[model samples]
Target: MDRDMSVEEHLGELRRRIIWVLATFVIMLALGLWLAKGAFDYLQSIPPAADLPLHAFSPWSGVRVYMQFGFILAAAGTMPVVLYQVWAFFKEGLLEREREATIRYIPLSILLFLVGLAFAYFVVFKMALYFTTTVNRKMMLEETYGITEYFSFMLNILLPVSLLFELPVVIMFLTRLRIVTPRRLQRMRKYAYFALVFIGTVITPPDLISDLIVAIPLIVLYEISVFLSGAVDRKIRASEARGSLAR
Candidate 1:
């Protein structure tokens, strides 16, 4: 039997979900600490450089590493729980049919986010590092760095790419909701190109090559979004037309 949930009940459930999510994050944090070195090494593999002496400001550096590893792992490990909670909350606000339609999309969105982060870590981030390091190689009198700074840079690149990679999911959902049409998105193609180029320039270092590298993938993602949007638009429109006919 279906029963309506009260506001108090919903809040209580949310609190419980938050606790579960936090517990998941803590467990993931411990696991991350155990694998911190491996994670660091994986990130290091991308830069393709000789052993450069890296320092940590003692206790603070140690803390930074622990926190950084925890953040990355927590984001990765708790993503499903996080997405579920988000869906749960938003689903309450949506029509029953819409909620049911959206249930399966969350996991796919999470996968896309991970793919984006991995691409950033392995491809875009590495390329950016290579380009930047080579360009400023002449300025590095000391050939040494801080571990905290290194991790900070890693996070900076990883976070944005992961977020940006959600474009396809966003397009799909907007299409599903009939909020945007493929024709409209297509019409804005020139604007999207400029917007992506501007964003890439802002994120990447001040170099033509770096900006182009970042912008190129973004443009491709936009084009893919356009395709997905068209498909979703057709599906939603067909569903709507069927409903209208039935009425």
Candidate 2:
């Protein structure tokens, strides 16, 4: 992270940041592989998974699953570094107030992301898995789940929901930057609902109950985002009023 520079210097800076990000990713991936065993155990001990053992159909299935888990862990762990790099890259273009605002909310974004992960795993994932399994049983179908498939299904749900949890922070940031306002969010509400519901449908099991279980929280997140945006918009207006009076 550095100040404004000549064109060549800026290119060098960009390359240096890229190297740092790649290095972080490699380190995190290694650490993730080491921790994946514990994660595997924990997942197996959980409710839906605990009910039935997962099998590997292919010779490379175990390796693939471990790698996927490691990749996910690495991706999650590297998020802060990624955000820092992004902020650093554009820091020179941002006002002091914008830089400060961006820095202040990064940690909140990370916290919300972690909360989303937990919510997806504990609630949405469970509901979807239970529904799918119940359907198979109702149809009198044999239930043999591959480890890879089970986890792939899981990652599909976990990542999106976790990202949705960032809605409020994203709205607050956009509002602070004057790129988004409460009125815009309100006007866009119905379209956003359609998109969120569509996403919820795509990610969850193809069932109304599962879709609602996933979509309802997402809808709530949007509402909370609108509320937060309104609050930030109000503060901005008040600050501008005060500054004008001072002038």
Candidate 3:
């Protein structure tokens, strides 16, 4: 498995992994749909949304939102399997220690994703929603919201934050593979902060506080990524030195 693979062999392996991932996704999708109603009810019961009325402009809007929820649930459920498949696909090319280290990231990646979702939902999202609603109240605008639009906005905020939270894990993995190093990340700090600030502004309302709230965590995460990458680099170098000495 460590040796070079022919094109056909590679394709066959890829096909097998794809099949496994797809099968898992399908099962998860079904489970998601079955649980969607309860989950939707719980969401509506949350304090921010408790009194907010959701109108379905069209008859299909409710169904669409239900399906959207299903998709979200399915995606979350399938993420670990997908990550494992990805790691397995590339693992044959890795040294024994590298393989072991990378495999541990799958669960950690999933945990970080959940943390991101919670942060967005509880803190960032609540603040943004309150700000907008308060403005609407001040302007004397009726606060009618479409069910589809509401869910869409929620997903837009939740999904990206969760995915972006994987940055540290991704950087650490790439560091192990030698595709990137701490030195490169350190050199790119200013540019990275600018990019993250832009992303924060794009995702958040035009309020400076909201922008900083999102941007600051991202900057911190990037710094954490740099630190983790440096640690991994040191470990790799130490391991290599040990191997050379033993030889």
Candidate 4:
């Protein structure tokens, strides 16, 4: 009966957190729509895109792109709030020291996400776009890009890179929770590299330069994750040693 009651309480808490995240997302969506026009214009002013002319293939294309931009922006804005809620929901089950350490991850995760987004937008995305456009120009093809297609490509590259940037933090968290260890990560390094390389190939343009540009960062992120996991393991071992000495 007690276990059943605890499960019910956890479910209820989860439902509440979901509701809060949804509400926040909805509110931000409205604000995002209002601001999306300026944001779109600013993005267009950037290189690669700046030289190209974007078109609306259909009457609804503009509206659809606006909504897409709004959705992405709103989701990005609400991510921190949602992450915090998720952390809080599971926090009570953690030890005092663990709770203190893990709580700091909320902000770190958000920062890493933003860094990824920026890197994708400023570097990988730009290079890919430029490469494609240059090829088209060289082939004597007129470049008429649809707004919808343009944004779709951007999101495809941006979202994955941003999420991939969280690898270190996620690995560290799992290490802290004893779900994964540095040794395990080290053992899996070659497989992880293959997976990351595959992901980079999928996300970037089909060219060696683009693939290498994207894959290198992902590989670096994985290495960083391993290093962070090692740090967490050392800390855990030190804590255990202290506790044993005290006893």
Q: Pick the candidate with the highest lDDT.
A: 3
Total clashing pairs in model 2: 0
lDDT of 2 at 109: 91
lDDT of candidates 1 onward, in order: 0.79, 0.88, 0.91, 0.88
lDDT per residue, candidate 3, 1-247, as tens digits? 3458998898899999999999999999999999999999999998677878989999999999999988889988999999999899889988899899999999899889989999889877787788889999999999999989887888888888888899999999999889999999999999999999999898888899999999999999999999999999999999999999999
Among these predictions, the greatest TM-score belongs to 3
Error of 4 at 176 (Å): 1.8
lDDT of 4 by residue, 1-88 (tens): 1133477788888898999999999999999998999999999898767877899999999999988889988998899888788778
Please give, for residues 22-135, the per-residue lDDT of candidate 2 as tens digits.
Answer: 999999999999999898898889787889889999999999999998988898888899878877887776656667867877899999999999999998888888878889
How well does each candidate superpose onto the true structure, as a TM-score? 0.81, 0.88, 0.96, 0.93
TM-score of 4: 0.93
Model 2 misplaced stretches (Cα beyond 4 Å): 1-12, 240-247
Ranking 3 against 4 by TM-score, winner: 3
Clash list (residue pairs), candidate 2: none
After superposition, candidate 4 runs with Cα above 4 Å error: 1-5
